[model samples]
Target: MATLVAGANAALTAENPGLDHVVVGMGWDTIPSNGPQAELVPFALMCDASGEAVSNDHLVFFNQLVSADASMTFVGDGDQEQIDVQLGLVPAEVTKIIFLAYVDPEFRGQGTFASVRSAHIRVATAENRELVRFNLGTDHLDSVTAMIFGELYRHRDDWKFRALGQGYSTGLAGVAKDFGIAL
Candidate 1:
């Protein structure tokens, strides 16, 4: 599998022809600390060409768990969630799907990336064959409350993936506002 850094792009379809489905997985290690550890939650935002959610129900996470067209859904395993997306089945209006993680504000645990040691996001086939991986460097950003790990976007008739590794201090609400998501 190819390892990518922030801003690197991979053409998943070109790399492996006839690939119709993939599992986007994210996992992290947290620093040991007293009291509660940070509760990190993974989510995906299905957006239009303008990079905003096409609708209020276009978010897929632990709460909603699925997208409107059934193109994206979460498969819980271990302490992380694997996202499954049927590329061809995704609505044409949807041009991008951004994968992100946030320290759940509602959770009683520490709500920041200060407790995260290391993290990674990867794409694999339905059979668990990893295609590409991006190891996010979470070093020194103690105030970060939300992070954008990667994204899958439409390139003409094909789909491509990019590593982001961007962080936010305003928490998930800031991310929601920027992406036009209704909470």
Candidate 2:
């Protein structure tokens, strides 16, 4: 069973201490709408110790699935997305990896997170043993277009996961800006 984390900033270590690879999975159901089709896209932003993206290569999404070092790669599609991270391969300068769920532009133009149902993010070992999970639908907000679900950061020489549960009304652009991405 996975450990359930209740709030933001809650930290949990991966299931197997010896594991070097972990998967961050996010899933959501699209609520029926009269407008364009609803799609939830998951992405990751790799940041340095200053919480700023090291480069454009650090932003992994549908178009750019893998990071520069191949430490992180986005997997799956549609309502579900998974990110595979090779902790040992991540660069020493990279200090944090943030996972996010965004309402695709077509869908965001018509609705917000309120149109997403049963949204959740989970972290697990390479073998599929879940370590921690956070449900992003607990407090759905119509004004928000994206969610900063959680983050994996370097703690001493080890990595730790933190449930952020933060919402952004400015869409992906806002998130990109916050992480030092030019566009």
Candidate 3:
């Protein structure tokens, strides 16, 4: 059974029995009349205790599918994107993973989340059991070119997920910069 949660600060632990991995899935529909089709690219940053990316190698996306320690991976493409995390594989130096979606810059000038019929970010198990989900819909400001959907962070010796739902007009680059990525 999955827990439905809301707000940026809401948190939940991945304490389900036999759970060793969590998949962060993002999905969206394109609005036919919204100029050229846009891609909602999903990515994640492995951050340390201070919320800064540990290194460029920790940026997982289409071009870079896996993290340095094999703890994180970006899978799938197009309207549906996913990030897989191995709870036990993450390095102790790392403390958080921020899951986000961005409107490809190539399509940003003409499209935005407003053109998305519906979108959502979900956390689930390897066996396909949903743990939690957050809807990122047209209600968002049209100027938002990127979104920080949620985050998985360490709380004590356990892992927890927080619903972020924050928007960014600077797109993916902005997010990368905010997380301490050089470029």
The regions of model 2 sitting more than 4 angstroms off are: 6-15, 76-79
Q: Tens-digit lDDT track for model 2 on 6-50? A: 454434443355768888888888778777544767889889989
- Alpha-carbon shift of residue 1 in model 3 (angstroms): 3.4
Q: Which candidate model has the greater lDDT, 1 or 2? A: 1
Q: Candidate 3 lDDT, tens digit per residue, 1-183?
A: 444445644344535655668888888787776364556777888899888999999888878899988998876543288888998999998998888888886753545666766677788777667878777546755788788888888888778777777888888778877889887
TM-score of each predicted structure versus truth? 0.95, 0.89, 0.87
For candidate 1, the 10 contiguous residues with the lowest summed lDDT are: 72-81
- Local error of candidate 2 at residue 163 (angstroms): 0.7
Residue clash pairs of candidate 2: none
Instruction: Give the Å shift of residue 66 in candidate 3.
Output: 1.0
Best by TM-score: 1
Q: All candidates' lDDT scores? A: 0.87, 0.79, 0.77
Off by over 4 Å in 1: 76-79
Q: Candidate 2, 32: how far from true, in Å?
A: 1.1
The alpha-carbon lDDT assigned to residue 161 of candidate 2 equals 83
Model 1's TM-score against the true structure = 0.95
Q: Say which candidate scores most in lDDT.
A: 1
